[model samples]
Target: MSTPAEFPVTWAPRRTRAVLLPVCALLVVMFAVIAVALPANWQFNDRVLMVLSGVLFAAAGLMLARPRISADAEGVTVVNFVRSRRLAWAEIVGVNFRQGDPWASLDLADGTSLAVVGIQSGVGKAQAIADARALRDLVHRHGH
Candidate 1:
């Protein structure tokens, strides 16, 4: 069996952040530059709106980068795009990351599953599989 990951471990989609953050920043800068370069006759509010739109886009990008999972001795904390949940080690039954799945997920004892978007196959398949295995090892060591 594989060794369990140490407590206080955290996993996130590095590629997603590396790619999305810079693109978002670039888009924001482009929007700001376009706003400033608008035709002289355009209303000032229009420029403000353009800049605000850019801010919104950046916010969305930030949200997309937010998914992460952190584990400690007591439990694991999962932070997805719009929600965060804490699950004790005992609460997790298993970790699943089948082919074609966007990300890994935790099957809980309560018959529910929680998506672990932090380990996304779309971002990096090999890394995601390794992460899922690490998580499975953790569950076997601590939860079972």
Candidate 2:
């Protein structure tokens, strides 16, 4: 016979990119337009290349738009650009969101640190602080 299982998520922060990407896109567009229009003389290829490069750069930044962190009974899952990390509650030794840090970082028992990009400071200081507090509470309640 198989046993039914239930795992409740303790906490999950709103992704910072939800607030950042739109603002970043607006700024990128404004700057791109300025760059294109400010020049008195420009070749068609150079203008095309300039605009293409600007768009590509913005795309690279948007790659970070999918960062997220989720914690359930089993563990925490952190999804940041290009990588994902899953850690057990006991593996987390500490959680720190310091004064100048971009996002929260988890200190593990193995002496390594992992970044949780779902919560970031730049979007809004108050929101970031609240998210960090919530994360710490989750670690305290679910972790050792």
Candidate 3:
């Protein structure tokens, strides 16, 4: 028979589009409108500035599509927007979720905490809290 600790555990926040691609698209549209609405006498530099601002918004939106946390027998992997870190269970000491924190994070044995962007407070308090507890449990059951 398989033991409880032997089972793999994967938990992530409930995905919401409240601030994802839809918002990104809206931001781009707004920028586009601004670009077109600018004075006809404006120099080429003004239009370039608007396009660059739109590009930044679109890039931010694309990054939001890739946050998650996954863990199994060996370790855990935290995939934030632009950075990803993989740590063995032995390297993690605990999980933390504090008020005002944007997301859940793991307390590493090395004294540094690794943020798990997959579970974010932006998703809502209840959901973020629940995921934090679940992640903490996984650490408790599997890690130190």
Candidate 4:
């Protein structure tokens, strides 16, 4: 059986393009450079660079593709390649929408911050603001 408290509220990677598009662009640039600079017989070095580049490209893709939000009865988690964060429902004091901001974030009672990685950054300003406000309200209603 399920109760109101049992329902899970989850947010995930909504726009992977933020992570993927840059990595893809870098890969293209690197490929062009390698093709232009390397000689035909440099097989070993070419292979090594290709392998390294492939690893980095894959890493970036994975970071972008990875799920960024998971909220359950306990808390929510947000993952970023640079840094990941977890916040218990009790830990989050509030959520706010900022003017001219590029992304959504959680404002903790401790005066720290956590970006809402699942929100689309480039969406229409009004819609994004409204969504941010709605998320804040949800936290207020159901979180701490």
The top-ranked prediction according to TM-score is: 1
Candidate 4, residues 54-100, lDDT tens digits: the string is 56775677666554555666676766656777778878887755776
Q: Candidate 1: misplaced stretches above 4 Å?
A: 1-5
Error of 1 at 4 (Å): 5.3
Tell me the tens digit of each residue's lDDT in model 3 across 1-144.
Answer: 112354465555546544577777887888888888899998778977897799797888878767888888788889888999898888889989999999888889999988898888887887778777877777776786
TM-score list, all predictions: 0.93, 0.63, 0.70, 0.66
TM-score-superior candidate, 1 or 4: 1
RMSD per prediction, one decimal?
1.4, 6.4, 4.1, 5.4
Off by over 4 Å in 4: 1-6, 13-39, 65-67, 123-127
Better of 1 and 2 by lDDT: 1
- Go through the candidates in order and give each one's C-alpha lDDT: 0.92, 0.73, 0.79, 0.65
lDDT-wise, the better of 1 and 4 is 1
Candidate 2 per-residue C-alpha lDDT over 40-118 given as tens digits, one digit per residue, 9 for 90 to 100: 7877677777777777767776766767777777778888877888899989888899999988889999999998877
- 46 Cα displacement, candidate 1 (Å): 0.5
Deviation (Å) of 73 in candidate 2: 1.5
Residue 24 error, candidate 1, Å: 1.8
Candidate 3 displacement at residue 9 in angstroms:
6.2
Question: Please, what are the lDDT tens digits per residue for candidate 1 over residues 1-144?
Answer: 444535689999988889889989988999999999999998999999999999899989999999999999998999999999999999999999999999999999999999999989987788889889998899888997
lDDT ranking, high to low: 1, 3, 2, 4
Model 2: CA > 4 A from native:
1-59
C-alpha RMSD of candidate 3 = 4.1
Badly placed stretches (over 4 Å) of model 3 are 1-17, 61-67, 98-102
